[model samples]
Target chain A: MFGTGQFQLYNPVRVIYGKGELKRSAEIFGVSNVLVICDPYVSSNEYFKEVMTGFNSVFIYNKIIPNPPCELIDEIIESVYEHSKGAPKFEGVIGIGGGSTLDTAKAVSSLLVSEGKLADYVEGKKKFEKRLPLMLIPTTSGTGSEVTNVGVYTLNDIKKPMTSPTFWADIALVDPVLTYSMPKRVAATTGLDALTHAIESYWATSTQPYTEGLALRSAKMIFESYEASLNGEEWAKDEMAIAATIAGIAFSQTRTTAAHAISFPITSFYNVEHGLACALTLPTLIHWTYKFISEKMDDFVRYVGFKDVEELAKRIEHMMEYSGFSLKLHDYGVKEDELEKIAKVSVEANIINLTPGNPKYEDVLEILKTIY
Target chain B: MFGTGQFQLYNPVRVIYGKGELKRSAEIFGVSNVLVICDPYVSSNEYFKEVMTGFNSVFIYNKIIPNPPCELIDEIIESVYEHSKGAPKFEGVIGIGGGSTLDTAKAVSSLLVSEGKLADYVEGKKKFEKRLPLMLIPTTSGTGSEVTNVGVYTLNDIKKPMTSPTFWADIALVDPVLTYSMPKRVAATTGLDALTHAIESYWATSTQPYTEGLALRSAKMIFESYEASLNGEEWAKDEMAIAATIAGIAFSQTRTTAAHAISFPITSFYNVEHGLACALTLPTLIHWTYKFISEKMDDFVRYVGFKDVEELAKRIEHMMEYSGFSLKLHDYGVKEDELEKIAKVSVEANIINLTPGNPKYEDVLEILKTIY
Candidate 1:
């Protein structure tokens, strides 16, 4: 009478975690020829040098911008084809930056073997089958891009999501050293994003036996380590790195629900950083979702050492504030009057279906108003 | 901060778990010309017929005996070669029975491509490199063999263990239906076996971030459901199946520690069933290990809803009694005089080195004497 569901969990990524994982990864992965995709900022970092040491020939594509555009992916694909001529075709693609770089690595790898424009796949018009062996090293703990299956990019000014079984990474080599030099603000913001990802996945309709424990443990780790991690504590940074990757694996198995859905429009229109935008609604949403998930809420609260749902929500709100996230929507360019439209966009986003109770648009409006 | 240890987590098995997972997995794995290994008992069962329909050609080798002997593996390898003469080499090895049957699958697959006797690998005298695609479907919920990397066999009267990265299964199609036919006693024994695997792995020295949560979660699932599962509850049977496999994955990554070490000789030298041997000393050992691990003990005891160690230990003892497992060594024809030798063999087993706090031989002897 037990396993009463139809769900599939396919996480093939080999995660090698420890203090010097990045340096040790090259030998473990054993690649002779590779393409290294990086954000402009990450390619200039010292850890990026260590990331490329054992490769025989390393082709660098370090121009990925946030919400990576189609033109850049096409350009990178052409460059990869030209560079691999006569050489052993690139054995793997190593994405060694933040979300954009990793998404580009996945998108570019899919484009290399499939027949279609990038937009067609992201827009869900075409299906892509081929994937390169991928080794993802996240420079930021926030995006969890290393382990997640989805490849998010901007298509005609809208962020379009694309993923296939092929987009799954073969290896996720997380090194805290990569995140050690992060600016305090970036560390705090991204750490909060990882925390929200864990919490939202815990509440998602698709949450199951496997994702449940990972999400709870991840949330607990981030709660205990995020502040210290932001303060550049080495141990906390290491914990956060693992926590973020685990959060990514959790949410990837069960895609994000309403928190991410509602945050999208705010990030799109208000120019708020994605992490901060997510943080703005997360605490109140937790309070609202508490009624629908009292059992899980109780377990998580006790496991994470919070007194109650209100206590948990207050702590998360405090975490956002300490992480330099703007709690009020008005702090960003959004007017108070725009709350209704934001709530409408969240309902239309269709992610609320992934929430357990399928929270109504009025509930979304109420949550927005409370946060505002 | 965080991770101060050196560890790796690599589990690539695609586990399709549910009531209909066995049927679903056939289409997903998409194989033909398979060698289906089974216990002679399982081959004669109705489920066995259903297991063979999707394949183009099925080769049956149903001679797996308990504590699978090295000679049996050699015989199977020869028969596999003879049966597939001039035909396609068996593309996949589908193991569908108890622990011995699945272990035989791994041993036969390992021997097919590597030029050596099976005992050589078990004795650590040879390393095999090639792997056959393997699909493991467990008929019994006890062994957790479907997901574990190691193959255990009898070598010169000792239960010798052999494992390689290549020994891992490509797919674990866990169907609770296969286990619904288990005799009540078999259910009790295998469920306890899974519980012990979970507990020992939770405390192994090699245990790291990924395995820790899985072990704890598996342990909790067993504790909550093993009794109901033994009482012929269908849902509990399904949960136990998943829990057992998860526990296998946990211990396979970190290896089992002192409890398993102690239990091995007891099982090998005595005629006791492996699970009963493990259950005989488990509760007292928990009482013993509690002194060495206050923080972890507190977490586990509270997480499982016990008020304290005393309560936890008592509940475990009650569980053993209820599961029809003999708690005293004397009841199984073991004299009190044998405790010292048993403890000596346990320490000499060298697996105690993997236990945190390094449990002493004297401590093991004391635990054995107390249980006696």
Candidate 2:
């Protein structure tokens, strides 16, 4: 009689959360030779050499860029082959940085072992059956790319998100100390991204009890720690670090909804930060999705210590303003005429259908117009 | 600064939850020939054949007894060898029953591939490196054995709980339909077990945010549905089944605390059912542990829809009374003088130290006397 609640929950990522965990990577990876993928900022950090001390041999590839392109990932694999003289000498792959760097690392790890360029796999022409032992460490509190089995790469100037069984890393080491150096603006934006993940996953039609539990706890923690985390409080950064990963795990099970779906074009066209772009639509989406999931959202608001969904939505806008972000699309150079195009693009991402009420193009355009 | 919150969360069990998930067991297991370990009651169940229809060949071993002893598990493995004509032909192992049967199945699956008797492993003489692909299904809403990597066995008439990495199943199929036929007594006891798991895991010193979230969600569901489930309501039973597995996942990470530690001797000496026995000390422990974790307990109580911790304790006692179970040890044939012995045995469990206040023998005796 209760068959409709059918769902599957599976995330095989071993998450090690704490401060000073970066140095334990070699021990957790259990490999002597490794390929390190990172942003240049990560490799230049003081702890970089300390983290690599235990490995017998290491090769650092630090050319990662934001919105990692398929060719960049292919270059990473090619560099590895050129460095190793075509021998599979690296025992594991370790990725350390923001979302794009980690996403690139996922592709590099898989492509190093399997045949083909990153574009082929990103386009769904090839399936990754296996990869080197992989571990991800996020240096930012936002993009929970460390825990999710998803990697979004830019293909032909378009963001393509794909999932593979092999993308599930063997370990996700969330050392909040790594995030301690995040500039205030980076922290603010990424913190918003994590908040969006928690809120969207909580109300997604695809959610079940396991993910709901995670989303509720994560959303509460993000709300508590987001402002303090951006203000450079070590303790708050620590909480934000853990909360973001928990939120990532939540959305990993029941992918994200409208906010993420609409964020693609907003970030692509307006040059808005990925997380800030996701958040621009959040307050509106929260209000929009409320009627469909009012009771569930009320449970969330109450559990997170909010008075109501209206207060919850207002609190999000308050956070953006506090972080010096304008909450209007016009402030980000998005013209009113472009709202329809953005709405069209948003509806194209299939995951938007997982949103409660399954907002169509007209609904999407109405939401965009309301926010604009 | 946040180093103390350091923890790891990893559970590789693929959980498929819904009604009639049993019929999809063959598809989820992804194997043909199978060995099923179940209770005799389960083998005779009307849906048993329907569950096994998709398998190429099946061996049903229905000798599971409560508090599964090491020798009995060894015999199940021996029977499999004899029946298969000395060839390991079964591709996987499926366990469908209550806790004892599932625990036996975990041991059998591990023993089938690794060398040595079950006693050797139970006694920590050997380690399990691998197991046949294993899937577990629960027919009762208590014990939560389906999602945990723990198995309790009787070695010398004493319940010895052990954990193994191999004990985590490849899939946990939670088909609530299987639990629809539970007698009121079984339902009440098992429902209490799930609640105890949720509460104990929440208050365990070893807990982190990930598990605390699950415990809160599961405890709330159990509170909302346990009474209806006891009344043979299908929807409530469905919630209970899902809640129990979620609680299992929570405790799988943190282990249980004082209530469970106190349960072993109570069940062993007085023949009280395991779940009911575990629950016997819960109300007292809640009050005892409150002072140490008052704020956290308050959070849990509030989230579970109770006014306060005292009210939560009373609610549990009320549930016991409603279920027709006496809350006193004397009614269960436990002697007044025996309270000290039970205290000693309870404190001896290493897990008792995980309790909030880390109660010692004297405190335990005081708790027992209070409950008495």
Candidate 3:
């Protein structure tokens, strides 16, 4: 609880959560002609159709790709323009899927109002001046993108991203019922994604009391519920959904660190699920970062209900094993030579800046080598 | 943890916490022409002078009276319009002081943008639209008004009246140094105000998972630190300040209930400090509410580190005794005849709707009788 401390935590989205909150989306969105964005899987779900019954004027864009490619966003913006009669104006934007679709919705809404290419707005290059009313409904419980002021998108053949205080969702509808339909593998990967978010945000260089409190609670929830949720236990699934969303909000504010940074390259190159990719590096990163901030690690371990840092790291490894995710980078088809390229790209990633204890490039390489 | 079903929680105001965060106010505010609405005490503090140093164009409105009056807010708005030559249009509004000043700042900013009287926009009649960019810096660490979407002001000859969510501050700066200057009595009463907020919000009808988590943390912090902070202990003071603000944010989302409703008459009639007045009825309300929601009370008791509900009630009694606050209605010069009138007023207050375990008028009367 004590350290060389100063931090800021702020989340400004109104969240409505429960079993059937999706029913209220139309009312919540008001009279706006909404641009409804989702993944192909989500767009075809029975639950999605049920939720969309009353929303007659919604324009569906189900082409959102993972990592939210910049071109996909441009396509959505063009669709919005054509559908809205060349005005490119939507009364509101509704994203109803996992992080990718939600991130795409945010980027499209921001781009719809701003006067520039998507790359011009990456991470503090320019502040977003205007955005349509953006509402997010996170069906997967990972990527708290619904309530965070961040939208992570791949740009210029790189996983570079941008964050602006202005990029927040106006309303976030998190219905646990939406999460109940997820496959076991989807549940596990997303749950691990949320866990990584909570753990990394708690230890990020910019962690604040507000975020720390949230991240701790989220970690505790995930530690207790992630496995149960994957096993299709109802109570645990409900808790996991809540925890994932909360952790998303937490990391969205503080930003993820080395594990998330290291994860991007792995996910992009190896086609690993984003959550699994992040989870793979998490245990090693935690062990390494623990050496620099041992006391904070102790707090984190205790907060997450582990007896010690070693126990926590072991639990993370066990979770990855349980998920059947490949433990070694080589198993994901990474060549021995690509490690250096990843290290170079990762060293420049935003997560490198967010990583607390400031691990050097050499330290990063060593961790990657061990995983390899 | 299991009984109370589903709820939503979201607050999207970035909180910057530490010593010297006040100096960064200008950077967060992003404008030079700032109107600083503060109380006389806060206006005179050296720390406030340090905060003011960052901005060249600053207007000071130091007439914030206890339980701020609506007319006073009108005066401040008129002054802002008169002073700034209508140029920058008050790029930012800064509130520095206790809840009254903070509330005044909220009201002023909200009113500046809206097209009607302040009272017309108190939750029901009209939705508050158009508020200038607002920042709040609380000195007392009580009221937690800095981070909340609430602004309490005296309205229609009533005390403890509040405006709606449109009053949410864009930036809530919680600098421990600002709170270090509060007088012991002020610290005690305001800290209790925060404690009441946490307790009441936990039991609020609208209490969601998000607010509940924050409320529980806030209650734990207040119970552990309020008394020590009252005695002018430095570390405890800091914790108490942070706790109070957190509680404010918690309760601001989920408004206050029976105890807060009961306290208004006491403050209006006897001029008791808002926090102490609210504290007087808390134990009685908690004890009564426990009968309806024993499981929830048990959770609260455990979270607050009490052995049971009895111990929790006793601890609150001990806090009042230690802080030298009068617990009896008689001490505040109320007659036996006033009890019925007070109960009538309490029922009339819309806050009765916020009471979680809805006590009947007789139940309310019984709680009042115990305090009396």
lDDT (10s digit) by residue, model 3, range B1-372: 321257767565767777777878888777788888887777777887877766878888888888776777777767777776674366778888887788888888888877666666653576777678888888887888787777666677665455566677788888888888788888888888888988888788777655666776677777777788877777887788777777877786788888877777777777888889889988887777777778667656654557788898888889989988778999889998889888877787777777866776787788888888
TM-score per model over all chains: 0.95, 0.98, 0.86
Candidate 2 chain A TM is 0.98
Cα lDDT tens digits for candidate 3, A1-372 = 331266666777877767777888888767457788888889888788765656667788888877776776877777777877878545778888988788888888888888766777874566788788888888886778887777777776766566765578888887888888998888888888889888988888887655666776678778877777788777887788778777877776678899888887788777888889888888788888887778767756654556888899899899888878778899989998888888877787766787877877788888889999
Model 1: what is its DockQ?
0.53
RMSD to truth, every model? 2.3, 1.4, 4.0
- Report the lDDT tens digits of candidate 2 across residue range A1-372: 123488999999999997898888889889999989998899999877866978999999998989888988888887788888877699899999999988888888888889978888888899999999999999998888988999999889888899999999999999888999898999999999999998888888898888888898888888888888888888899999999999999999999999999998898888899889999889898889888888778778878878898999899999999999998999889899999999999999988999999999999999888889
Backbone collisions counted per model = 6, 0, 5
Q: Positional deviation of B41 in candidate 3, in angstroms?
A: 3.1
Q: Write the per-residue lDDT of candidate 2 for residues B1-372, one digit (tens) a residue.
A: 122488999999999997887888898889999999998888998978867978999999997989988889888888889998896799999999999989988999999998989889988999999999999989999888988999999998878889999999999999999999888999999999999999998889999888888998889899888888898888899999999999999999999999988998998888899899999999999999999999888778767778999999999999999999999999999989899999998988999999998899999999999989
Q: What is the interface RMSD of each candidate, in Å?
A: 2.2, 2.7, 3.6
**lDDT, each prediction:** 0.80, 0.89, 0.78
For model 2, the superposed segments whose C-alpha errors exceed 4 Å read A1-3, B1-3
lDDT of 1 by residue, B215-257 (tens): 7667777877888888898878888987888788888788887
Residue-wise C-alpha lDDT for candidate 1, range A83-157, written one tens digit per residue: 767333887888888888888888877787777688888778888888777888888898888887788888788
Each prediction's DockQ against the real complex: 0.53, 0.58, 0.35
| Stronger candidate by TM-score (1 vs 2) | 2
